[model samples]
Target: MVNSTTGNRKHFIYTLAATTLFISTYYLLLPVLPLYMQGMGGSKFKIGLIMGLFSASSLFLRPLAGQASDLKGPVKIMKWTILLYFITPFFYMTHSFVLVSIAQLFYGFTIGAFTISSATVITTSVPLEKVGQAIGIHSIALILAKGLAPTLGTLVHTVWGLYPLIAITVLFSFAALLVTWRLPEIKPASKPGDITFRQVLTYRMVWVCSLVLLSVTLTFGTIMTMLPLLALERNISQYSLFFTVNTLAVVATRLFTGRQDRLTQEALIAVSLLLIFLAVMLVSGSYSLITLIIAAIIYGLGYGAVYPALSTLVVLRTPSEIRGSAFGLFTAAFDIGVTLGSVWGGFSEYLGFKTIYFLASFSPVIGLICFVVFLHGENVWNKILMRNAAK
Candidate 1:
């Protein structure tokens, strides 16, 4: 057996490198994709449809990816998925909006496959006592990449133009593929009986957790898709600064709250959602760029904490044999939420951006309400603790 600390260090290094490269490439492409579409004479509706296609594809493919990880191992699934990072960007270079949209559909599946596998790999690789901190550190890489990628991408586009930016994105993706190639394979746990997908579906906690993730991600999807448009309407084009500040805030909070997973899971989730509520409320009312930036910072703090907390909650209850499947189901739920948010957020032109943000601001509250109603009475965490005590 590998030394626990050494294994964790290796897992952290590989996961962080992969996540950073992937997120950086993703963020670099996000602000420029619509502009590229318009340059190719694509309509607003077409752009929205194309963007929504990514999430739609992921929603359908993530469960299969998870099952594959469970059967074949995460490292194997990751190897196949990461190759798409190199392939997808070549399609973007064609400058055909429709072709690019089709490519994005495949690209989304690539993301789903790798993400679910990565989640499973990391969760299983780390010790249970260190899962929260490990995930927190891993998330910081993505947040940091997100904070920096937009500004750097915009600068590259400004200086060298669109093709060059595309090239840079492709380079980042290739680098991520290389990092993933070095990841150690996780050994699958053997069990006597097999649980079908349908049986996994029977567990109410799984669905509830999935719904909670979906709701939280919906709020994020709305903000990501609409915030730039809202900023444009307000004549504030420097929206990249909002991400920078928000990421910095998240970095700080993660450093301080790295040990929070050891605390009460319910309380952490509740506090995070409450913070998200206040941030979204502030964002909806903000007419100035500075106010919007402040809102982003607060939102980042909440966003950064919620994900790892949710993952810990899910993984803590999952059997080692089906952990990959649980993660896949979780990601599928999030993809569904993101798809709905992006598609519905696109229609905000009709209802208005303010209305959309206002409605989205209440999503976390809905999730909180659901958790309270369904999962609160017995609560999965209490049951797990009791089981461990009995052992």
Candidate 2:
């Protein structure tokens, strides 16, 4: 039931190529955009607002877009959205916040639609049993972007300045569009959006899985914001080394353990959540640099496995008819968690880092309990209740 025929290799390659370009372009811009906004005389609040707008709009619009993909097909939505990805960057040339904001609105449409449609296409196109493997491959492309794009983006901006960086990103956007065109399109398995936005938003497991991912990401967000400050306070200069080890461990975990057929997606997720808890626990105790590194490795294993496994679980657990909407809801959950975590990181210092890290470490425990109890434990309890009633 676990390892079956992987769908189409050609489509997988195309999807990988398109996502890598799209994700890479997005990642490349992620760090550079704030600097651009700052240079344009935007205040810190304005910069935050500008950055926040992209995610805010993207987060809210996901379900609608997902439903639309179910009603329509991937090709039309993808064509327009991909074009916007190629076009949105030019608006920054105006050096105006209003224009940039508008561009970001369209950017939301670009990514939101592309996310649902591309995921739909990839999942539907693959063999029913290979969803795990397919999702793993997809996550590999994304993880690589997470691993490499920011550094590359910063390097480009540092060496050639913003305009050149913009140009390089623009090129990738266009390349993504081209690659997207080649990716085979899939119509909704459901009859023309028979599944409404309400259905997508209300899917029980999506919400549960989202909470699980959110918990882990919350911990990740905390580390990202706090670790550097923690390092500076401790006078440990090789803070960047944490990222290196973390990224490497994540990639290694995926390439190695992810390929094995020994575990189910749900089981993998459960293990990952445990790793996240341990990682944060170690990080909370880190008075020394070695603890941080060890914590990073543990967190990497958890993160690398959970991401792909959860994606596969989402696709598998949801009804095929409304899978696009399912993916949208999941995406929304993931993004909202990161955004909140980032905000939490900023506010944590007010509470003192030690207290905050301790709380963050403990927070995921709630997610673990809820996920297991609701997803599995509740089922057993229900069976017992039914037997007693029958008696």
- Which one is best on lDDT? 1
Model 2: clashing residue pairs? none
Best-fitting candidate, scored by TM-score: 1
lDDT per residue, candidate 1, 314-386, as tens digits?
7776777777777789888888877777776777667777777788889999988987777655567667657
Would you estimate the TM-scores of all the predictions? 0.90, 0.81
Residues 28-79, model 2: lDDT tens digits: 7665666577678865445545655565677788877777777778656767
TM-score of 2: 0.81
Judge candidate 1 at residue 344 and give its lDDT.
65
* Per-model tally of clashing residue pairs: 0, 0
lDDT of 2 at 324: 78
Query: Which window of 10 residues has the lowest lDDT sum in candidate 2?
Result: 1-10
